[model samples]
Target: MKNFNIRSLMIFILFFSLKISAQNSYINQYKTIATELSQEFGIPTVVILSIAYMETGGGTSSACKVLNNHFGMTGRNNVNSSRFKNFTDSKASYRAFCEWVSKRKFYEKLKGSQDHNDWFVAIASSGYSTKPVEWKQKLNLVMKKIGL
Candidate 1:
């Protein structure tokens, strides 16, 4: 029993380490684009990164893979449709996200703000997610996990 417990613990540790490593790699891959968007759009970098990470599942979501829609953004006149906005590339997707956010009414108020809570609240209130509360909760978890 003791040996089994030790092996299980080792396996768990290995899995956790791998998850963290993958997350770090994902962040590194997109951090530059996120940073640039934040600077240009006045959105917090952490907010942008956390939302992208959660929405795309670290860029593994079908929307990200197929549509290059990193933020789960739906196409115009297709909000109720399954179709998402297709981008030329991941950077284009990121830029589109920033453009969408910049148009939000709360953008001017929360612009350049580092407060994730406020940003999440504003975003959720803006109909960004069908399940706003749950979405914010998950975003919080992603932000925490990413150490942002």
Candidate 2:
């Protein structure tokens, strides 16, 4: 009985620590996503990650889980996504978001090009925000706390 109790407590503590670590991992994951976006779109990973964290709470969010949505994107896509089965993961959701973003007319400006500043200007000038005024500021606040 004593051995079993001690082992159970150790397992509980180990599980708790792992959970906290995964929570912290989001900042790094968000940073990675930001870096990838900047390299491809001329937007800094900080800014992009900030936006994603605001939009999806670093992708551990209920919105992403319930809706498979990463960026709060909504529309009628021409991508022939009529089949709605086998959506088993967030990677699929993020891929869909990327495809949708890629298909935008303004995104075409990025084709065969490499200009970071210009890409950011395009993102801002394109009026992509339906809730812009507060999202970025809120993301910045969270980013500061995470040491990003």
Candidate 3:
């Protein structure tokens, strides 16, 4: 019993450390992407991350698995409509999202304006209509929670 307890304790500690490390990696990734997106699109990094988190559960969801897409991107890119895969790797998805925003093409055309407050609603409207209102609220709430 004593040996078992010690082994369990060590295992718990190892898992705890791994969890913290994973979180740190995620934060670092978000920070890097946010910096790039902020520079390119003039949107707040936290807001961008909030959108990503909501769309792909911070890179743990299946939509991200098949889509390589973080922003709930629809349809295809570079491939025929039929051949297009649904997933984009986490990093690539974020990069693609940022590029789409920065260029004012594709997804950019979907937005009515660049106004911060209007963003959530605009995106929410674009196919996100069903979840638009809730996502907007959540996105705004996340921005507040993160001090963004």
Candidate 4:
């Protein structure tokens, strides 16, 4: 039993290490794009990264895999279906998200702010997600986990 417990603990550590590594890779892959979008859209870098991470499940979601939509945006663009919008590339998806956010009423009000909480509140209140409270909570958790 002691040996089994030791093996299980090692396995758990290995699994979590891999998970963290993958997550770090995902963040690094998108961080530059997110930063560029943040500069262009006046949104915080942390906000863009956290939302993308949460929506895409660290770039493993079906929408991201098949549609190249990291933001879970719904509409018809590249694809015929009026579901998730398909982009020519992942960068396009990120650009589209920035554009959408730039058009929001609160954009000018909170532009270039580094406060993640403010961005979360504005986004949630703007009906970005159906569950505003829960969405903000999840964003907070993701930001914390990612050490942002």
Candidate 5:
């Protein structure tokens, strides 16, 4: 029993540490862009980062890598019929994501909302995703995982 308990503890610690490391790596990579966007757009930094993390699959998805679309945005760079917008770089992708939000009139009401909950509602109600409740729940979980 003692040996079994020790092994279980070790495994638990290993998984816990890995999860923390992965979360930290994600923050290190994307926090800057999220912070900048938050400051510019009045959206909470945590909200932006959480949403991006959920959408882009921790910034490792092919959609984000190849299309530069962190927000899963669909549409051409200039053509409406295009399926997704592609950017030259991640920075452009971030900018485009912010721009897309800014263009929405409903987003104007979201400006200056400090509460992450409100941001979640704004995102869902704005038709940002087909599964609004699930989307909000996932984003909230990401926020918690990131220590936001």
Candidate 6:
């Protein structure tokens, strides 16, 4: 029993550490770009980062790796013949995301809102995705986890 407990504790610690690392890794990697875009485009930094984190699973998703599509965006795509735009890099993906936001009816509202949830709600209200309600919920959860 004692030996089993020790192994269990060790495994738990390892798993907890990896989870924390993945969480921080995503923020550390994209926080700069997200902040820059937020300042330039008026979108909330937290909203941008949370969306990327949720959509890409901290940049570990297969779509992110193979298609450079961190936002699950689908349009003008030529990368894999799946009708989704395959970006050349993470920066390109991020830029396209910003463009999509800028063109939405909610863009101005999002730009003016300081609340992360408001930003997310605006995105959903604008029909950003097919399942806006579920999408907003996920965004809210990610925003909460990220503390923004």
Candidate with top lDDT is 4
C-alpha lDDT values of all predictions: 0.89, 0.57, 0.64, 0.90, 0.80, 0.83
Q: What would the per-residue lDDT of candidate 3 be over residues 47-102, giving only the tens digit for each residue?
A: 57778766766566656555566677666665345433354356677777666565
The 10-residue segment of model 3 with minimum total lDDT is: 104-113
- Over 1-148, each residue of candidate 5 has an lDDT whose tens digit, in order, gives 9999999999999999997887788778878987898899887788777877888878777777777777787767643344777777777777777777777776788887888888787778777889889889888888877788
**Compared with the true structure, what per-residue lDDT tens digits does model 4 show for residues 20-65?**
9988988999999999888888898899999999999999998898
Top model number, TM-score:
4
Model 2 per-residue lDDT tens digits across residues 30-102 = 5655456557654455555555565676667655556555666665433435322223455555555455556
What are the TM-scores, per candidate, against the unseen true structure?
Answer: 0.89, 0.51, 0.58, 0.93, 0.82, 0.91
Q: Clashes in model 1: which pairs?
A: 42-112
Cα misplacement distance, residue 7 of candidate 2 (Å)? 23
Clashing pairs in 3: 66-86, 66-87, 67-86, 67-87, 67-88, 68-87, 68-88, 68-89, 69-88
- Count of backbone clashes, every candidate in sequence: 1, 2, 9, 0, 0, 0
Candidate rank order under TM-score: 4, 6, 1, 5, 3, 2
- Model 1: per-residue Cα lDDT over 40-118, one tens digit each: 9889889999999999898889888877788988875222356688788899999988998889999999898888899
Candidate 5 error regions (>4 Å): 1-5, 76-83
Model 2 stretches astray by more than 4 angstroms: 1-23, 76-126
Order of the predicted models by lDDT, top scorer first: 4, 1, 6, 5, 3, 2
How much lDDT does candidate 6 score?
0.83
